[model samples]
Target chain A: MITAERKPLDEIIAMILPFKKVLVVGCASCVGECAAGGEKEVGLLGSALRMDARMTTKELETREMTLERQCVYEFIDRLTGLIDQYDAVLSLACGAGVQAVAEVFPNIPILPALNTSFLGQTKEAGLWLENCRGCGDCRLHLFADICPVTRCAKQIFNGPCGGSQDGKCEVNPETPCAWHLIVTRLEDRNQLDLLEEVYAPADWSKKEGAGPRKIVREDQQN
Target chain B: MKIESQLKNVLAAGRFAVTAECGPPKGADPEAVIKKGRILKGYVDSVNVTDNQTGVVRLSSLAACVLLLQEGLDPVLQMVVRDRNRIALQSDLLGASTLGIRNVLCLSGDHQSFGNQTQAIGVFDLDSIQLIQTVRRMRDEGQIIGGEAVSPPPYLFIGAAANPFADPFFYRVIRLAKKVKAGTEFIQTQCIYNLDRFKEWMSQVRDRGLHEKVYILGGITPLKSAKMAEYIKNQVAGMDIPEPLIRRMKSVPAKGQRKEGIKISIETIQALKEMEGVHGVHIMAIEWEEAVPQVVEQAGLMPRPTV
Candidate 1:
């Protein structure tokens, strides 16, 4: 899922400084699962801003709205009627959510309250580990279900680079070496010989095209 | 005539190849590069010009390679993936090649956290292995990394770094084999202080018959002082300095430590020269350039082979 973390208070404050009234938008999808931009987070941010406004010379009004999923137009339509009451929207979803709000209401400004971190999974409460690079080519089957593309620092399929120690990465000693995990898993699966087979350099054309990515299903479109 | 570099020629002729590192000074003084190049001129076959080795900003490795060329020293332009995306790295590879730099060492550089500026963003668009294949494609197939063909291609003899002491030691040689498979012609290992571990690594390399496929250059950096030895053994990552070596450095008084360092380096080089699958010695006399000639002469590698 697309994961993100809330922006710092000062940065968020600066984003909504020009607006006298703002809607704190939240999503119930990936960002909600990460606890970064859920309904609870929207209430906390709205309360914090309201409290901060009480201390300042200018009075600021904040409204809270949580959508089922902020990335879709149908869910985002929940704000169409109430959006005119506020000057701007402070979206607490991933980057996609901010765009969704802007696209739904083109006249109102949409400010992202969280920085989208990565395509990842929550390992435990408050702990998220990146698991995908969206390289468009998923070769996890070849490597015992481990994604070296996202975990390895260099993103080289032929690695563990020389700095890998005790199955830990040289870049961050705390992080496990992605290739080590792959190799050990392969060994356990009696596929050690697969390590000898070299892989071609990743093709960026399919992974990163000239612009943004798109997937349109003609069957589902109609 | 098909060979593009003197280092390649030495390796092709089956002679013990000698290469050392020359870090471009942080400041804008070309004289320092020239001085270091001259000191290592006849002592080593090729000098590796480091590209912001620890990520602390220095003279660009590309520019330093050009300066070393003016000094009549064969410069092995060391490029790290830590600082460049595919566009910049490939463009620099072509630029360095056209500027007469023949030998290129592809490396995934040290983490930026180790450098002076900790806030820098690392651009590891392609790791060392992929960089090797990318350069190979450009040189051999006249194609860019994006699969676009170009009129003129850059010719280069590619090299990559290896570390025998790094953990999961069983996989070091496997990784080396992988790099060789990725088109790396030569391999310069991380500094060798623990000979037993390095020998163990070489045995694995022999078992896989990787030494025959690629020229393996053992890295040797003389320990200047006991503090340096301790710092390397404890502080440095991916190094394997045994407790005995560290104790030996401490055994010597402060004044005699440099001499002890040189002696240890010479002895290490001699032992490595006799080892099977060991192609040559890459003496990385960091900052002590003057000590290099003496070490090379004393190690009986004085008359470098002129192939």
Candidate 2:
């Protein structure tokens, strides 16, 4: 689930105040799951905007629309003819969806209503915790499904640093030591021997230093 | 009753208590908060300041409510335990009490995934019912959630939320009953569009003797456009927009649709007021606070009853 907190009502209102007709677009995928840019939120935002506009001099006209997935071109294309109906578009999707809207409708001014945070999973019904960085690499197989890249304060590739205390990270005592989690999981699975493998220093060049990365699936391509 | 005695006296006089909702400013803008407070001042009995509403962070609800208090409005600090554990929730309640914001509406806010940070963890340490009970226990017994006696436990007129139209209506009502048991003095339902269904549920509430225990406030948010109406029907759970209403919204001249939306809301509120167990209506115009006064006036509700 893509978790997003709504930008403050005033900030969002201020951004769209200059526009006459605004489309409050919501994403039915992640933003919907998180409740930020979902259909309900779109209605709530549109209602709020309408109320705000009524209070102001402009008396703006606002509409709401939600797509199945905002990041996909098919969903973005759904708004092709509808784009002209509004002076600007307020995308409730993640950053990717906002960019997708911008890319698809280059002429329309696109504003993001949510600050896209991170790749996470719903621990329960409404809670989403960051679990992945989409680092273009999978090291979880070695670390018992815990990604030190995300959970570790240092993003260390090797064993626990001296800072780990009582299974908690010393950097912030509230945070659990990522290496400790990894060790615990390995120990549970009776794969603690995996920790014996002295891995070389991570090649930063292959990760952050590699710049923008892409994968071309020849099978899926025409 | 101990703390709400004064407000109860006002309610007993057959004067409709006015309650307004103030959505927290998205940013730290005192002007917006103050402006909203001023707009609702003297018109509403109490103003509800929503907490990180819908899991979206704005200015904190407590800060906004405190600001409203400073602005001379009786602010009902809306609290959601979705993001906080009992410890933090109790602390915030204590903080609100110390700040002299008396009224509180406890809610299990929308899932954390609904916000901009989709990956944020939700700490549903306590659901709305438990939260209400916790507040009651603290107030009546002067004890923390762990049963430890606290010096000078805060007194609050704790409120809870319900969705009569939420699917599986029986369960929603059951939960409402649970909330009443947990010490919810007031039950403000989710935005209700279908009055017949609401009336039916209110009848059930009456039958169960739930209405006697708590004041039931029907939630109403006006639909501004056909698209907005459709979103409510398709997306919002426990919310239903009758086809006629949707068709009416669509039939309106493009420019006149907003007026039509307001009309529908007014009719809903008027009809809801006629329901047997319905005490008052909680108008959640979302950002449409301006329309709220108009809706209330059109529905023949006095802006504020004379003391």
Candidate 3:
């Protein structure tokens, strides 16, 4: 899921200062799972904004609401009536969700309260680890399910590089060397022969090399 | 036979070869490279000019190799894939060839975080194996990576690094085989302190008959002091230094440590000379090129072989 962290309180406050009345919107999807832009976080932010207004002697009003999903047009329509009641919409969603809100309410300025991090999994409580680079092409099977493109520091195909030691990466001692894991696991399965063949250079055009990528299924798009 | 490589000829002649490394200075001074090249001129078969070794920015290996060529020494141009994309790598290969560089060593350089520029973004567009293939294609097939025809493709001898001590001990030989399959003609290993492990790696290579397909050069670096030994054993990544080697260094007095280090390196060279499938010894006397000649002579490898 897409993960994010709320921007510092000062940056958010500075962004909302010009608007006397602000609508704080949260998404209950990816951001909610990561506990960054869930309904509870929206409530907390709303109270903090109210406190700032009282301490600064400013006539500011904050109304908090959480949508089932922010990226879908159907769920974003829920804010159509409430958007006009506020000066600006402060979105506590990922970049895609913020853009979706902006598309739905083209006139109202959309502000992002959280910084979208990466496509990752919550490895454990309070720890999120990025597992995918969204490179468009995926070859996880050949590497024993480990993504060298995202995990290896050099993104080396024919590795582990010389910097690998004790199953740890030279870049960071804490991070496990992806190639080491691949080799060791494959050897256990009697599949070490898979690494014998030199991997060819990646066709990066499938990723950002050609520019922003898009896909359209002719049968499902209409 | 594919390229005019003095180092290749020395190895092909079945003579035990000796190679040394020359690191480029940090500043834009040609004198440093020239001085080191002069020191290693007649002592070794070919000199490898390091490419931003340890990720520290320095004079380029290409320019340093050119200086060595001017000093009447055969140079092995070390090219790292960390800072250049395929286009730039190919362009530099052509440039190096045009500048009279005949041998090339391909490597995935040390991570930039280990260098002065910790925040730098490494441009590993192609890994070392792919770089070797690219060079081979350019040299043998006369085609660029994009399949464009070159008017005159670069004729070069390709070399790649191997670490027998790095993790998954069983996979190290397989990695070397992969490099050989990728068109690398020679293999230069990381410095050897644990001779037992290196011999195990070589035994595996011989088991697969990979030694006949590619030349293996064992790496040796003389430790200047016990402190340096400790730093290498603890701080240097992927290094497998036996505790006894450091103990030996500490056993000597402060002033005698340098001589003791040279003696240790000479012993390693002598041991490597008798090992089957071992083509040569690459003494990477890091920052101590002057000690190379004395080490080479003391190892009884002097009166350099002319192929």
Candidate 1 interface RMSD to the true structure: 1.8
What TM value does model 3 have?
0.96
User: lDDT score of model 2?
Assistant: 0.77
Which pairs clash in model 1?
none
What tens-digit string does per-residue lDDT give for candidate 2 at B1-307? 1234223444556555557789988897999999888876766677888988767879998899889888867777888766787779999999988888788888766656557766787665565666787889899999886679977989678787887664334444555676787788887887877777877888889888998788887887888899999997765544667888899999998789889988988888778777777777777877877877787788888747644
Which has the greatest lDDT? 3
Top model by DockQ, which number? 3
Docking class of 1: medium
Candidate 3 docking DockQ? 0.84
* Lowest lDDT 10-residue stretch of candidate 1 chain A: A197-206
Interface RMSD of 3: 0.7
Model 2 chain B worst lDDT run, 10 consecutive residues: B1-10
Candidate 3 regions exceeding 4 Å error are B1-3
lDDT of 2 at B191: 82
How far out, in Å, is residue B273 in model 1? 1.6
Each candidate's lDDT (Cα)? 0.88, 0.77, 0.92
* CA deviation > 4 Å runs, candidate 2: A1-222, B1-9
